[model samples]
Target chain A: MSLLNNIYNQLRISHKYVNRLFKERSCYISTSPIMRDLMEFFDDKKNWGATEVKTGRSWTKDDLRIKSNTDLHKLWYVLLKEKNMLYTMEHEHNDQVRLFPSPERLDKVLDSMENLEEVVRERNRAYYELETTEIGEQTHKTITGPFGLEIDYYETEHSIPKEVNAQWQKEQNTKCRPEDVKSFLLKYKEKEYLQNKKQQRRNFNHVIGLLNRFPKMDMEALKEQYPDVDIEKAKASRKYKPPLVFD
Target chain B: MRLTQILYTKIGEWSKKYANLPDRYIKRAMEQVYWRNPKGIQYRPNTVVKRKKFHFTLDRPWSAQFAETNSPGRLHPKVFVEPIKKWSFFRGDRVEVLVGKDKEKQGIVKYIVQERNWILVEGLNCKLTKLDRGGVKIYIQEEQPLLVTDQVALVDPSDLKSTGFEWRYTQSGEQVRVSLRTGRIIPVPASAEETRDYKAKGLYVEQPKDTSEKDLGEVTFEPTLKTFEMEIMDQMGIKEDRIPKKSYWY
Candidate 1:
């Protein structure tokens, strides 16, 4: 049924010359030995029992995107099987207390798997947008925290409502109360004011120090550094002069 | 505070970039702002809340999110077939024999001959075939074949490994033996120096920390697609596995 569906979908595609398309171009495999060999990417007899098996980097998104959807789906399973094989081999190698040759092959397979998934997802998203009103599955929502901070709440399915769900209620009810909020506001404002005052003093003293240290300072750069500070007025101050005489 | 400031600047730049974008970009930006939970901003009510129809039942059990306390029945039994990523060989229980008027030969299965349903044997007597430029398929006619005729038997390649198989990392000399049927490692693989380094870097390394509510709260900070996908998992009622926590990029 699924194979028929795939064929039907292929036939439904918009092409200028439909009759010219070859039957082989469609999704069908006549079960051949050489083709099976192509599917199995392991070492031949000579290479078997050998410690290490070398492999190349994974297929990137750009490479995958150029292929047809049917090919991509087939490739997904190939990559998936490859990853599982590598993992099993690596796992066995570890148990035997021997080195698993070409461990990076596993990493490459994993990378290819990731890239393939991304490509599939990109296609899925495009297809979903083209046909449906939604973007396949991802969702988001706003939720208010206990501290009255409004946070986006991602909607999730739950057997029980938020009011009845004991675990979720604990998190929701833990929010700060009005009394706690007022006290938090007071301290938060005080902290901010103190921070600004300290910063102002630091900037003021730094300008004076710059003037004292570099008497012939680059006035333009100084102005760029502390735009609010009056460099000329700061230079005129007694604190601006160097402590020791150059002579 | 510096980090927050930098994040704000980055977000501001992103918002500016999509200021004139069509509906899709605006929607994506809005979703990002919501999920990221940016500080010091009131939640906007301008967007529509898209509700999804989700069916979740506690009785069904979620395999992905919540760990199953018991082994799943044979219906969903985890098959520990050989993973195909690394170099692996299935030691066949029985060997197949190939015979003909020209020659007869046999060999051990170093690997699965998926295409021809044929196995490549170790010590087999056979006539080699050669193709010529004259469009004639020719076999190298040798008076003698390599091996004897008794070298044939149909073996279940799957059944040979009751003792299980071993995976060897050829580069690092690390070996792991796991049961092909059960997927359980009889002798767990030893951690290598590079594996230790990966653990230190927090890549897919298991944490030995005590599992608690505080530990569970750490879920909020995890930047994995699974974090969000867990919502779907919750809907599926699939119990999660208690595998060692390792860093996985979404």
Candidate 2:
């Protein structure tokens, strides 16, 4: 599907002429048969020094879901090769201190690859759910770490069972001071609280300034916009005091 | 997070490139093995002490992510099979072998050839070989000539005839296979236990029609396509035993 993307078309040509052209010129055209392999890695020769290269959006999960397994598997390898080529070119360009052409090409390929995996994962989950009563997503758990803090750890397959594994046991059994960890967590929470408090103050002060500048300010809208800000307090602030004026 | 994933993916590509390095970049890659996890703390690879070992990192590169639990079954690395796209049929399903030595033979689906478009029917076709070695007779049973996807069709449970299958949800929001020919709500063997209690109690509601959820665009693989290594595999006569590796354009 990526192969036919963005090729120049002659839609303006009459159907009869288009048919004749295809028949005479050979329907299949290998523009760069000589550099077929190189085409995988590099963009067109014309785009060697071009500023930008435009491409289509990434493959969506729904789009990939519709593809047969064989097709998805085939496209995966194609995309994988494209990614490798893109990486090689970008690495070379970086080494030579040149701009990697439209770096988002790399992004687009990666996005497609990701979406492909997501689609595959969805299929796997559905299949597993039907065949077995479980969604076959990679499972993880929040376990207490060495620091006495809960950390998300992925469970992996082990050659030796956990009951008999010595190496894993050593990693799991680490000495931790609960007091130290509690202090550390408290400090972390305090930092977060202080940052949030500062933001709230800033928003409140900004609201006061706005109300002062505009006497006919929509108080209800302002209250809705900044729920954290005490609108009544902002209105009572000296900056927001109504200016006395002779009529 | 997205940028990190892209960079990590590039590192994976670099790992692959290490195999055919220009001898100039191997040293650069050896100096640092880039690895990271989305949520975990970042750290440099400080455990390495060699250069040659750096190659084949793509196969088993150092992963900083919390290790995954061991997978129970695996399609061989050489054999990258697609995950089952739909639950149209299953192992216990009674399928008719449409083409083979036992053509038109109806039998229960013994096992599915994972990743490959084939299935083995129970006790249908078997190749038996008797070998006498070291004064001992060995009987080897092999199930060959698997039923290809095109050559076989699913047999409906009601009439024991081939039929197209559709998906429909039960009253309890359970997905079930519906036999198109009979309009019989194929008991979701997995989810709802096809219980008389649910049906007798008037709890089961059949969906009006099996709606086509989405356009699953068509995708096809050139079955004949083979790489240079596959040709070698073919020469070795292990080609049939091995899945063909797809070409990686470089």
Candidate 3:
């Protein structure tokens, strides 16, 4: 019993010692010889493996717009680094099967980045607009697709000229719709047309029924409601021959 | 209502007198004929004149066609762009913390938060956190804000005092930082020293070069925030719109 107890103590110490070794190595490797920029990606050493992390609000376009291009430029990097750091930490945590702290911090950084991009785009547009009397945003055009559907095609610069470039030519060759697509579109349109006709017929008959039952009904209002229905013809028809009594 | 119904029925019968017999049912017969024999054309019904369209969304909006003509794409963005041109302080530059417990304490500029306008100078401002490592508890110090850009100022290279700078044009049209008090031509930061094109922002080489070259290309100077402020109102004077829409954010 005493020997068994001694073995258990030895096993426990070894386990604790392994744990200490891991903790020591991680702490030393992560903490030692760090620079300022490294600080941007790393949470405070205390926040490492923390269950929660507190943060402030994301950057808004208006607030960002007020900042100098230089400041905005700087902020972009800080947020970017923070994002990479969070992504890495989260990935590591996920790998280790540990809970990642406040994921909203990542969201906050992303939101700020999106807003920053939007603001930068706005600035680019404004600068371009001022310099050259154009909105400077990428222009889009409506083009007829192979399926004969109108599609918006945004114009972009290509390094290879269309006529000379075999790849571009091959891609552009998708001008005519395939037979199956045409067939699919045809049947799809037929279905759509039938659905429309069904509704129209229903509306027409509904008008006749309405007129038959409501003989003293406001015909002008009824005609206004169902413009397609011929009220006088319905009245002359056999369906409208005998007015039904309202019980 | 009764009078209108009577009028409608009378008009309905009278309309047959005015029109040909076949015209009234022509549309209905056409729909039946088209339905019985499915053809190359679809949506043959009267109301279906225009074609429906499909808009294709690119699988990647930020790539393929999304790349700009001049640049490959937007900055990879994970890396912080060292503020060389726009912000006055550069990492490794000696600076004095203007605010907080570390006020007036001079230290080497370390990390900077460009957008939030925060800075962390080495050993200048420290926040204490109690941490537990395994079974051992220890105190950890986090170096963060002395607030940032406005919170600190570059220590004058001459006297090691805080100083402001203005841009001066060199003979070669390069812009250089002119220290306000001493009229010293403080070298343009290594980060800001590059030409305006692609090299404007990035990581600074760990060691700052000795104060040998300090001028910036005219193109490197970014448009100031104030240039956009009261944009319509310039040194030429404020031009009020004949009618202010008041539609813009201040």
Who wins the lDDT comparison?
A: 3
The runs of at least 3 residues in candidate 1 whose Cα sits more than 4 Å from the true structure, single-residue gaps closed, are: A1-52, A142-152, A158-247, B1-250
Q: How far off is model 3, as Cα RMSD?
A: 32.3
True-vs-predicted CA distance for residue A222, candidate 1, Å: 18
Residue-level lDDT tens digits of model 1 in B210-245: 123343233222122332234345655877888854
Candidate 3: tens digits of C-alpha lDDT, residues A70-156: 556666777777788888888878899988776656766777898888877777777767778777667887766556555666666
Give the least accurate 10-residue stretch of model 1 chain B, judged by summed lDDT. B51-60
What residue pairs are clashing in model 2?
A: A66-B216, A155-B68, A155-B69, A156-B68, A156-B69, A156-B70, A157-B68, A157-B69, A157-B70
Interface RMSD, all candidates in order, equals 23.4, 21.0, 26.7
Reference-based lDDT, each prediction:
0.45, 0.55, 0.56
Error of 2 at B167 (Å): 42
Instruction: Write model 3 residue lDDT over B1-250, tens digit each, in one string.
Output: 2232222222122112112222223222222121243444233323333111111111111122322311322233221111122445555667788777888899975554443335568887788998889989999887866544356777678877888777788899988777898988777445333321223334223222111123221123346434332442554387766974433110
Q: In candidate 1, what fraction of native interface contacts survive? A: 0.00
Q: Which stretches of candidate 2 lie over 4 Å from their true place?
A: A1-35, A214-225, A241-247, B1-250
**lDDT for each residue of candidate 2 in A100-162, tens digit (9 for 90 to 100):** 765656766777898888876666666667767677556788876666556667777665567
- DockQ, per-model, please? 0.01, 0.03, 0.01
Tell me the TM-score of each prediction against the true structure.
Answer: 0.30, 0.42, 0.33
Worst 10 contiguous positions by lDDT, candidate 2 chain A: A3-12
**Candidate 1 positional error at A107, Å:** 2.3
